[model samples]
Target: MGKCKGLLERLKNNESIVVAEGYIFEFERQGRLKAGSFVPEIVVDHPELVRKQHEEYVNAGSDVVLAFTYYGHREKLRVIGRENELETLNRKALQMARDVADRTSTLMAGNICNTTVYMRDDPEAIKKTENIFKEQIQWAVEEGADFIVAETYSDLGEAMLALQCIKKYGKGLPSVVALVPHSKDHTLDGVSFPDACKQLEDAGADVVGLNCGRGPATITPLMKEIKKVCKVPLCCLPVPYRCTPEQPTMQTLKDPKTGKQAFPVDLPAHTCGRTEIREWAEEMKALGIQYIGLCCGNASHYLREVAEAYGRSPPASRFSTDMSQHFIFGNRKDNKPYYSETLRKEITTANYK
Candidate 1:
């Protein structure tokens, strides 16, 4: 099948697309992969699983089926003693994503993430980082990726490098570069959110915004600042977990009872519900953010909420919640027989004021 509409054309036509990410965390939760290394070996190990995830995200209204290569870079694989599988993983993941995107008519994004080897002052670390992005991008180009998503960089310098690498190696593909600032609301290099976005835009990023580290509550504030400065279309894909002012990023979030950081694992209970995702999407659309999605902890249901809020009715929306068909809270006449009057009375003691 031919490629779908490119990101720039979609944005020009006033389209707001949802891009789903977070494969590592979700796969880890399903026991298909490990956490610390977070290499996307699942692409080479469980191709069907990765394919299903891409299909589900498309069904859930993700307009872009980003290749599950977020951490499939050389450095990340080297950590797991699988650096030899780097090329295999990147190519396989991109191909899997392409198949799903072609079937669904969704855009396929080549994903290059932070190499974790980049250092602010180390020239060798920067070169390694550039090399990692360059090789992955070359494979994406060969695999027919519609665009490139360079994401999860905490260092603005590294993000700039990724953008440069994409321009150099991506063969003119659009680049959606996203940053992940911690609780400080600035990059490790001390660049504020808005300033970082402005710099990316000036450097010719097709899209720039925040993703991953913060949730809706914490990320939105940073996005607001970015929106004020960036002329390019903005992208915002926050984590699905709840983040507050004090606990501004998932890494800082503590289990209320245990008082320990709840990130990476032990965060299922703190995930944002459908309502919160819907509200977050609504607010982002209102702010004119063009690309919206979820990062770590993302699921199909959450993407459904974001898509619905953006006025889309994807295939998965067929199963959206219909409380009227419920047993207790349902007001449908057909549901009356399912519950006794006494049961209803016992279940619902309060009514709307």
Candidate 2:
């Protein structure tokens, strides 16, 4: 939103694309990582060092970097003793992002995830979540975030609350809201696609889009319909595969894989169809996502494939291995050089195995 006008122009231009990597520091289902206390644990114990991963994504031709603060909401941090460190943690994430974005003109999108949910969707939970936006947004501005993305929302209520908070505080910053595509193409609130976009538009979101779903084929018709009606800009995010979160990232499969262990697919898991994935990319470009990005199932090679489809070549130095076990390493945002003694010593199959 600041000092990045040319960058924004590139994005605004025809057929532009960007990719976001990771839920890295985020807590998985049911909020397993307890707030502040677990930040270090999540990073240190998560097996993958995210910085290097972010860098790898950037190398794969991604134009934007997403901060790994998806679960960094105040409430989560409060679960741990580091409620006080909320600002510190959020700011550090921005700084880490800045460090990664520093090398190239790549932009950083600060996360305001966890804004949408049900069961916990009542007024009380919403109020607590609002405070999280307040804190994180303030820190993001202070730490120089280029943009703010409230991703993976299932409903519009949390979005409304978040937008209300933005009006109350965020004077001139640009914001993005990415919805999860569910039944009827409405948010979990039953707010229809048109209605959701309008509400989010009214709520001060600069760009509105959809991400984390069954891939492009399932999303194209709705997206086309959405484009016909919406006034603001459009963005699109697609995963590498259609089936499982841990579905085989074949192009993404790692030869010297590190991070989480992969499991057998027969046991009920996330999976994405490759045909669907390729079609999704082609259709998304056709359907009009000035900014195109690949989500979870994406690896450096996967992104390179998408970029090539768009007539663009991948930037040099991208490397990623899909999980045969469990974890997949994303863009290497490690500010540290790979030639450094520490990296050379630490990056090995023996260490992880």
Candidate 3:
């Protein structure tokens, strides 16, 4: 929680936003909640890709860079047969960040996601998540992370359980819990936003915010609801992936007969990219949101655009020469030292046991 406070203190100065993001695995576009064996070329091997994303956000003026481990939550990895490699995967991701971040003031929070699927329906599912998240928090703390964000939680009970794991094994690491809102204006499991806020605050969350699901336009209304009931700083990490009834893509496609073989189709209203991120940040500022960030589709340039807007300036382009100087993706050669450190004491009562 104290680590999260580092970003909070900086916000009190002037227009400030949390330059943060979602977990980017190699197979992000492979499927929704896909549990197949991870392709080596597609995952942790590309730490440089992850590092650059974080650096670009920092350069574009993000205050925090989350390690790319959202789904690294132990139980989810277990679903894909890589559960035992959790420690190795986590340690490698953080090291990648440590190498490239030199310019801006940024901190690294280990990210713990909800189970690949919500675990609210089954008691055993719930217990599995509790154990996995607790292990993630401790491992992140040991691997030199700055804080923790238990994010993308749909069911309130699932979120509450994740928070419980953090409180139990966080070893005093500061944390923020990102809650997903339900259709009736409550948590997916039927808890009101205000009520969920109270529980998180009671459990000592340093910052509470929302991400994924809703786009920027819908988020403004949602932020208002959170502001009324929550008293801590808030972060907004939305998804970068686009969604439609059947597919989500950066560009919708159509066959072309002429110049280029293919081109993007179109997006209906209620969905947009960069423009939507700008509009959403502006709305949050109006609502007195102290912490600002992007979740899903935004890259570092996108984050910088959001940060520049927070400062009341024009959004910086990703290719501007100024950006070249600021974005640092770290030192990623074919080989680098790997670490195996554990930040927690025995889960005296092993959830596994």
Candidate 4:
């Protein structure tokens, strides 16, 4: 309900910050709903779903529960004829996160993203984009957001504008600016990653790094490059979908080696497992990345792995073990079989070289 003092203190003290991804569209798709432009509609209509997601991330060890307002801005809502509910949707999004955060004492972050109008010479577009960001940031501050995140920009200029808006109306709350590079080294607009990091840092971003567009394998090298020029805190939250030059979005993604679709249309089939995610977290920690999180296609299970990898026990561990003692074949409870006593005893006594 108040400012997120604990998170601010951690950032100021140079401690690692575990951020949970604020992805709502994918969950909507799980319920067989349209996902493109109506995601905010679902947030307004299904507050409980969003709250349950926030709670899952909190239990998975997120220090911050970001509001599900990634694309709830005016333009986005206008596409679905819901522009009138922009303020109400954004406020409700933050409220859902706040409600869950109160239970765990986790911090809350108000989220905004690129406006997709990055033409610097277009005065009309620039003014419109500024107004868009201004309105969103105002709502975020009005709703008592602890911090703000302007992420997933493909153009450095757009990211700069968002950062400027945040600096102007963020009410001194810390802000993170995360870009989505077309490749590992440069934004889609051709700005080098280092240049983007420097520009954002100069524009008053508290933390700067990359998000979306690529997975951990591609982002690792890019982060190493960012570390060279970025002195401020770094953040990384890559999408789980595997991508190729020809196919970037989850629906179009393909495996580079196999030359085939990497996953079903609705599921993140290429998501890294707990072990791989842990390795990514460990590497980022070594690289002095103070802010680490997941992006699109991330789930509570992935967040739990990140928390456990960072030495925090997942809340589920309180009722379960890392290893399972029983195996089920199907949903039928009565027909299930258990491991034989002799086999269980032998496994318990098995020796390794």
Candidate 5:
């Protein structure tokens, strides 16, 4: 067993310690300063940017800093004409994470997800997927990853395959299998949450739970259901978007006039704030969740709030001598109705013919 396994065992024995896993794909996507998938390309061109994100998470109190390899698989890289850079991408991502984690004595986790190509009928495709997972896991272990996190998997079969790969190639490193469910009860492939978690546990997952499909509000009940069946330490890293079962993805937003899809980051209407995340962390801690963390759209400020809620010292960026001075934009000195002259004139003007 590896260090993460030992840490998880200590946590499971009621050690009163909480592990925070902070994801960086969304943060990196935003930092890429353009509109496209920021996978292997970012790892090749912006290694420092990736390192900076890892540093921020570590400073924000993340116990584990995951490598920015969420979509660095071969198939995903092929879409951007960089499939040949798979080894470099995965190794560099792990190195970047290890570098940042070393500075703060934080754990580093290697990440793998679904390949987006589930051809159960095609044996050749299955072999390809298996090889991809095997290679990724090997690199993770070789690159000094403290653990392996197989996340955002919508299919039970694929999730199990990832776990199997880790067990076979990860050399006894701790592994977490987090499923992306279609609803509160079942995974996207119609497998019940309990059944999915149970299968992963049986397949040697050190921890199992949900991530990336919904927010804390929706995932709370799902976590309860998982608790009823899964005996291992649970992991819940919900996406920060305000989505529901009816609308799983954030791509549902279409422009009213142009009918073009808008990005979730561009709209704050569905984003989770610090207060909500802190409340969610409190609830999870009460529910005996040992591995608590954030998923997509997770920022340093959000993780700082979670850390503070758990009675841990928040990052320096979130600390201040005066509580009222915590707001980046200073609070108003007085309560008064104020509006721009153009908006006020528009409100008072009569309709034109």
Candidate 6:
């Protein structure tokens, strides 16, 4: 079959692409994967679940179906004693993603994240990391992926290595590289966010920006900084959480009731509502971020709001909220005249009581 329009062609035409990440966290929330391990063994164990998620994101208006191969690398699998299944998992994830993208007419991106074993000045660790990236890139290329997405790297070196591997093995496929910074607003190795983004662009990344970690509140300001220095398209995919300046990253957020960290789970209280996600999408558009998505705490519903904000109505938009149809807050003229004026007034003012 013929390839769909390329990512660069769409972006060059000034289109806003919505990518839906966060599969590991979303599946963990759904009880499909382990929380701490986060290895995408589901691609090998329950392939149907992976396919269903791709369908959900596509229906929710994601223009890209990024393979859920985020941490499906050598290091992570080794941790779980499943290193023998590395190639199987990566290839399975890519094939599953490609099938969904082909059926839904969305872009399929091969995904690779930080090796979690990179050292700043150690050559041996860096070499191993590059090898880890190379093997994954080979499978993505062989699977006919549309592009490669390398993300969630706290170390600039690791992110750069991922990009390098993609460029060498991707066979002309586009690359989207994103970093995940902590509270200090800099990479772990002391490079500032803006500087690291600039370096990535200079190193031939097709698109460069930030992802994961900080939420809209924190990532927006950093995107503004990166935009000023980089001429390439900037991507902004933040976690769907109400992150504040005091608690800049999700990991630092606390349970107000229990007075303990509420990251991995127990984040419902801190989750950003649909309204908040819609507003954040609007702000990202205003800031000129071309690649907009929700990271770790994302859901299809949250992304539907994002798609609506971007002015594109995918199939899922049919179910979008219409307050006029609400039983209490609705104002449709067809409502039965059963309630008296006093009752209507009381209902409207009930929240104050």
Model 2, residue 164: C-alpha shift (Å): 3.2
lDDT string for model 2 (152-268, tens) is: 777777766666666665655677777877545577778877678777876677778777654555556667877877877777775444432232222222222342323212211
**Residue 35 CA displacement from its true place in model 1, Å:** 1.7
Q: Candidate 4 regions off by >4 Å? A: 1-4, 242-252, 255-267, 319-321, 324-353
In candidate 5 the C-alpha lDDT for residue 241 amounts to 62
Give lDDT: candidate 5, residue 220: 78
Q: TM-score each candidate.
A: 0.96, 0.71, 0.72, 0.85, 0.83, 0.96
lDDT scores in order: 0.90, 0.61, 0.62, 0.77, 0.75, 0.91
Model 2 per-residue lDDT at 323: 34
Candidate 1 yields a Cα-based lDDT of: 0.90
Task: Please tell me which predicted candidate would have the highest lDDT against the true structure.
Answer: 6
Candidate 5 on 131-220: residue-level lDDT in tens? 888889999999999889998888888888889899899999889899986554677667898889988988889889988767777777
lDDT of 6 by residue, 1-353 (tens): 45578899988888889999989888898788898888888889999999999999999999999988999999999999999999999999999999999998889999988888888789999899889999999999999899899999998888998899998988988999999979998999889999999999999998999999998888899999999999999999999988899999999999989979998787788999889899989999988889999999899999999898999899999999988875556787676356745576886675755
The window of 10 residues in a row where model 1 has the poorest summed lDDT is: 332-341
Question: Model 2, 302: alpha-carbon shift in Å?
Answer: 2.0
TM-score-superior candidate, 1 or 2: 1
